[model samples]
Target: MSSSRSQSIQGTLPVIAALLGNGFIAVLKFVGFFISGSGAMLSEAIHSFADTANQALLMVGIRRSKKKATNEFSYGYGKERFLWALISACGIFFVGAGATIYQGINALIRPQHADVTYIVFTILAISFVIESGTLIVAYRELRKTGGKAKFKKILKNGDPATIAVLYEDGIAVLGVVVAFVSILLTELTGAYYWDAIGSIVIGLMLGVMAIILINKNRALLLGKAIPEEVKDRIIEILEEDPAIESVTDFRSAIMDVGKYRIKCEVEFNGNALAKEMFARGALREEFEEVRNDYQEFIKFCVDYIDRVPRLVGNHIDKIEKRIQEEYPEVVHIDIELN
Candidate 1:
């Protein structure tokens, strides 16, 4: 399968798993919240609901990213994932985290008499089952992408949707614990406000995580650099080409929609025109080989030059200087072959 096709499948798989998992948890939590008047349980329910919605958005993004480039959209929709990822962050913060915190604060300020032990316990139990399933899917996906990295490294370098799912699993698991503690505390002290406080704390955490996801996606949308290893690999491939004498400079950019547009400047020894063509073709073929070997490569351009070809020189210093101004990369020279 093409690397792009494989990546597309990989991206969509996790999203499907997350959506299914979160959907089940949402239904269970909704029922649990209804049975138990615990404000914290209600907040947790909203969190799961928001996660379900976010996963749906992520799935849409992943699918949209597969659209081919068009005249109106030259770079294609690969970066659509980043855009939707940003929007998902907003929903998570506003709907999931915001609502939870709002309700929790209200409960704390105005204590209520609501028994929610059954709802809390049952929902938490179901959450474990659903979230675990989703987390397992995510881990499996990670392994395909090169296994799990350090937490900080993953946070810095991993895909936003993948990272967001991880956040969901971790937070959801912790929220369960927090809910259990709050329920026990309220039961022991008969202070319903403790449950509310627990809910509020969970909400705040979710909100913070959502913001972080947003920021992370935002950076990627703005065109972050490829990983160092990938950069080095690209360089190695270019250097290995026999036609390329030495690479003077290599630069790359991430255009909208996750397309990599690269430019390189290299110095080479004078060679026959036919040999140059052969070498260029060979180098491009090598590039294709490398791209196929690794999944991350997008696209590139290579310029091979033996020397700065002078158009006007010696007696025509002024003209040479003028030509240089117009085309900085070119040199000016005049040749007379009797």
Candidate 2:
């Protein structure tokens, strides 16, 4: 398979894993909550359900992003990934965090004792194992793209689908741990309020994660630029050509995951053009004498100016070809002569 196709498959794999895992875990959590009457268990159930739906939404975004370009959207539907990711963030905030917090508060006001503590513990253990599996898959995928960067930086700059799955599963694991601790504390101290506190903490964690995702997707939708290192590499490539005097302006924007559009304005070396014209015999000392004759000089100047554009065009073509070969992520490149 091509690299892009491979990347697309990689992007979809974590979502698929999360969807399947969460679907199973959600049912288990619901059963645990019903049997134990634990607020934390109920909160975890809601969180799992939200994650399952979020994965589905991510799949939709991935599919839509692959749609062919139409006249209405000449840039294709790549940005759809960001749009759907944004929607997923909203879902986590409202459905996952908001509901959990509200339930925790209600439980706090009216304490309720949990029954069948052993069953809750069993379900939490199983959920942890399942969530850990998904988290492992996501972390591997992230490492493939992230290299040695910090986890937070990777999430900020990585593909939206990968980031979504990574964080979702990570939070699920942490939620399981919190739920287990809260149940243990409540059972030991007989406070019952500890379960509610766990629920509230889980909700607050989800809220923070959702906000981070929202900001990242928002920036992407607004046309975030490629990394500084990437921009510098492109500039270095452009400057490598002897015909280019200097790059006057350079701009870049992310068009999709691992895709970018770049625009640059470069000043051509006037001396290079003069040398080429001299070597081609289009510009000669004879032209200097022709300057004394207005019509002749006009004709000579026109012919020389016409050849300049052709040379410039050829040079621009070479530069563009080199850039595209060197940077496969650059989907579109616009080079202007200054």
Candidate 3:
């Protein structure tokens, strides 16, 4: 199969797994919350539900992006993935963060005697099982693509699949911690409000993370430039070519989740002009050469060249004076090599 198709399939698989696993967790947490009247458990249930919705949104975005380009939309709907992904982030903020905070506020205002032990233990145990299942699937998905890279660095750099899984796992772990702390506090002091406050804090934390994801994804969707290190790398490669004198500027954008769109401006020495003209079979050939050298790190390169003009006026004056004094072709003397 084609590489693009393989990438698409691989990208979609983890989202599917996340949606399924999150759906199961959502139900479990909701049931656990109701049985034990644990505010944190309820908050987590909503968080899972929101996450499921976000996964669904991601799937929809992915599917939309796969549609063929049409007359009205030349770039097609690939950017829809960004829009949907942003929506998912909003969902995380509103559903996950909002619900948790609301429960926390309620707990603070109207303190209730919570059976902290049951809520904490049940959610903690189930969170481990459910989160472990999802984490395993995520790891399996990521491992195929060359073992998971640095979690946040990859997510921030440009690996959407890894980003999604990392986001989910990271948030789930935080929720567990929040639940554990709140339950412990309540158990120790018998202040039921502490559990509610914990739920709220977890919500806020997830909400902030959601905003960061949204901002990062927003930049990509809006055609943000590539990292400076990548630009420097490209420039370094170009400078190594003897034909190239110097690079003026370079820029790139994320065309899709992982695909990149690149453009560059360069300057070359006078001697390189002839070879460059001879080499211009088509733009794609030049792009292919660069792509081969850089592999997946670089999608392609666009090049332009300029040749310095000889100053005939000044050279002619000097040559005429010297030639008159010496022997040469008297009639329309052809210029000799200097």
**RMSD of candidate 1 to the true fold?**
13.7
Leading candidate by lDDT: 2
Q: For candidate 2, lDDT tens digit of each residue in 1-338? A: 77667655657888889999999999999999999999999999999999999999999998899888899999888899999999999999999999999989999999998884688899999999999999999888888877798887777678898888988999999999999998889888989899999999999999999998989899999999998888998999988777788899999889888778999999878687667666888656767779679998888877777777787887788788888788777878899988
Predicted candidate 3 versus true structure: per-residue lDDT over 1-338, tens digit per residue: 75467655555877887888888878878877767677777788888888888889988888887787699986566677777888888888888788778988887888767665465577677776777677777766665653366644445564454466557767887787787788778888888877888888888888788888789778877887655655566557556655556767666666565455555555645455445545765456665556657653244422142212343334434544453333121112222222
Residue-by-residue lDDT tens digits, candidate 1, 1-338: 75445655655667788888888888887787777777877887888889999999988887888788899987677778889999999999999999999999999888887676665686788798778778877766665664456656656766677777878877888887887788778888998989899899999999999999999888888877655665566556545544345657666544432245545565544353337455557556656656764443433321223222331122224433443443332221231211
lDDT, each prediction? 0.71, 0.89, 0.68
RMSD of each: 13.7, 3.1, 16.4
Backbone clash pairs for candidate 3 read none
CA displacement after TM-score superposition, residue 106 of candidate 2 (Å): 0.8
Please give the ranking of all candidate structures by TM-score, highest first, separated by commas: 2, 1, 3
Query: Best to worst by lDDT, what's the order?
Result: 2, 1, 3
lDDT value, residue 3 of candidate 1: 47
On a 0 to 100 scale, what is the lDDT of residue 212 in model 3? Answer: 84
